[model samples]
Target: MTKPIYIHGSGCVSVQPTFEAGYFFDHVTSYTQNPVPALDPDYKAFIPALQLRRMNKSMRMAIFASRMAMQQAGITTVDAIITGSGLGCLRDSERFVEALRTDEGSLLNPTPFIQSTHNMAAAALALSLGCKGYNMTYVNNANSFESALLDAMIYLTEHPAATILLGGVDELGERTTQFWDLANYLKRDDATIPTPLIEQATPGEIATEGATFFVASQEPGDHTFGKIRAVETRLEVDAPEIFISGFLQRNGIEAETLDAVVLGYNGDSRYDEIYRTLGSSLFANLPQIAFKHVVGEYDTVVAAALFLALGIFQRQHVPQRLLLNHSSIPPILRRILIYTQRRGQNHSVILVEK
Candidate 1:
């Protein structure tokens, strides 16, 4: 049997207030028409001025979140640093692309080019911590975070890495946001009616970006969020039935024992049925919750879900904003199942328990 991976500490930076405030998600923010940027955190608090000048937005966010997680974990070094990003350093990528276009591929600065790599953020974090351990980054679209998580699980089996740092980071770019809007991948501004993702539903989807970091350890600590029981991903699979059953069997979790189920319902009618199948059949009576309504849909949304799960474990209370059903079980939530997918591909199931 593999060692249980415990989330010793976690940190997140998103459109909603996450870093400073403990619980401020009373009112869910809606962007009925456009993609919104994540709320910026005070980088100076977690990062120094000299370092901040050399870092891009994604790098800064990753570093800050990682530092916060490490502080909460009460540890100085980690055995490995792993991260995932759908689009790493969008700001830097935009700058480099524009320079290549306007300057006809000439007079381009090497700074943006260097930072545009997907692993730059992870590299920066490792450098800042002076950590010379295993470092890796995943960029497999929606499965990016899950990929990193699965690797972390495998690494802990043989490496004896007491503490590991894992994270997912992404940023919204101007042109990409514009393209999404043009393709109707974004919700339109209409306060009188709910967005399509919540109602009409279509192939187009909402766009948002943020990052979440966690310090995972083999030994459980006082502040441990929960144990990552198992994680599985598939590129192609039948709808809800096979997916849920496979995950539960692999992890030895029966449907009836699940304490809570978190679904990635982004209001998109196109794929909401996938989650609905689980919600109605397998998790009908359990406390079901959703977060895309609050954080918006991005490749790394699962990272946000992980943060929310940890928060639920810490508070022992489900935020009313995330509740999808009225059924209230015992306040102590022990097991949580997080299900997420993008465009009917990259299906992932992450099981966590106290």
Candidate 2:
């Protein structure tokens, strides 16, 4: 049997002012174009100038978010650290490749080369927190966050008393965006903010980046925000309704009992229908919410959805903006289901109970 895992605290750094003083969805940071970059936060508090100088944007976001989550959970340290990222440190990777291409691998600066790997983010977090046990990173396309989440669950179920600092982060890069733009993977310039979900939208998604960190543990405490009941990921999405039904049945949660279902509707007409199929049938009357329009979509953007669920469990409030289909808020939000897919692949479903 799967052991119960609860989230004590969470932190997010995203296109919105997530790392700021207020709830991110409340004072949203709007955008008009694709490939939006995360708002810069004051990193000096979590990182010293000397170390910050060498760290890339992705690393900074990870460290700051991890610190914020730890503080909120009222814990000084974690037994382990795990992170997930699709394109880890693209800025550094881009620079390193450019230098190698330009100079034919002659006298290239080692800074970018040293920081370009995918595991570097987890490495930086462990080094910063002085944690030396069971550190790992997962890079599984858009399933990255869910991959890390499942691993954390397995570890905690076995350890029973260990705490894990888990997170997902991705950064924007000039060259990377340019490549995406050429491939038409980004929404056109005319595409506006608050993406028109279920409405006519041109092909492509908003290329944005951010990080979400959580302090997950085996036992619930005073700081508990929500309990993660189950997490599942699929490399390919075959049957929409069947997949969701099976997932819910496995977790002993019925569709009618979910207070809310968070869907990743990123405004791509080609793929948004994947969510619509489920929203229209299984969750028609439920308080259906979509978030990519708020935070924008990245490989690990589902991590932001997890963060959103934690916020709702923490405050018992779901801001009106996130509601896709309007309805009076539930008297009490007890169960939430978060479902997301990356371009119709890497499908993930997570169950959270408050």
Candidate 3:
């Protein structure tokens, strides 16, 4: 059996004020625009002004969130660092491409190119924390975060005494956003947060960006938030219900025993049916929660879902705004199953418990 991976701490920076003290999803910040930028936190509190000015949004968010996680875990450093980003340092990437295009033969600034790689966030975290242990980054579209999470679990199983920093970060790119728009991947009409769901759902997703990090270890501590029982991902699942059921059964858990479930309903009419079907059938009687509406949709947004799950475990109360069904809420929250997919692909299931 794999060793229990306990979450000692978590931090998130998203479209909502997730970095704010004492803020859960109780009151969410809404957006009327697509491709929304994450709410910025005061970076000076967590990073040096010189370093902050040199980093892109993704690096800044990643470093800040990781620091928050470290602070909550009461540790200045970790043994390893692992992160996932679907699009890495997007703004810097855009800058490099734009500069290269404009200044063909001239010497160009190399900072953007240096910071534009997908692994730079992990590198930045390692440098900031002085961690020289294992470091890795995954970039598999929507499955990116899950890949990192699964790796963390396996790493803990092999190195039971090791503590690792695991998370995901993604930022919006200007030209890329336009490309997504051209490809009909972004919701043009009615692109608003608190995004309309189910029958009222529209087409495409509300593109946004954010970062979420966690401090994980195999040993449960006095302050440990909860444990991740299992995590699984599929490139494409013909039937999400079957995939989810199999994952739960493998973990020796039944659908009916769950305290609540976090479902990814991003208000995309084309694919929200997947979640709708699961809700009305498998999760009909459970307290179903929706988060993408509040945080908006991004490749690594599911990292925020895991953050929300941990928050729920900590608070023991489900915010009314996140509730998606009329089912009887569990009196004592405990086990929660989070399932999410993007455009009917990259389906993932995460089972978490207190």
Best by lDDT: 3
Q: Model 3, stretches more than 4 Å misplaced?
A: none
Error of 1 at 15 (Å): 0.4
lDDT of 3 by residue, 261-305 (tens): 999999999999999999999988899999999999999999999
Local distance difference test values of all predictions, in order = 0.82, 0.89, 0.92
Which lDDT tens digits does candidate 2 get at residues 105-163? 89999989999999898999999988999998899999999999999899998889899
TM-score per candidate: 0.94, 0.97, 0.98
| Cα deviation of 9, candidate 3, in Å | 0.6
Error of 2 at 24 (Å): 4.2
**Clash statistics: count for each candidate:** 8, 0, 0
Better of 2 and 3 by lDDT: 3
Model 1, 1-354: lDDT tens per residue?
Answer: 566688988888887778775654666555554576777889999788998999987898898888889888898788789899988888889889999999998878989999989999999999989889999999989999999998888888767645899999998899888877787666564311123333455555567778899999777878888989888888877766688887798777788888898888877667887887777788888899888777877888899999888888888888887788877766688989999887788888889887
User: Cα deviation of 152 in candidate 2 (Å)?
Assistant: 0.3
Stretches > 4 Å off in candidate 2: none
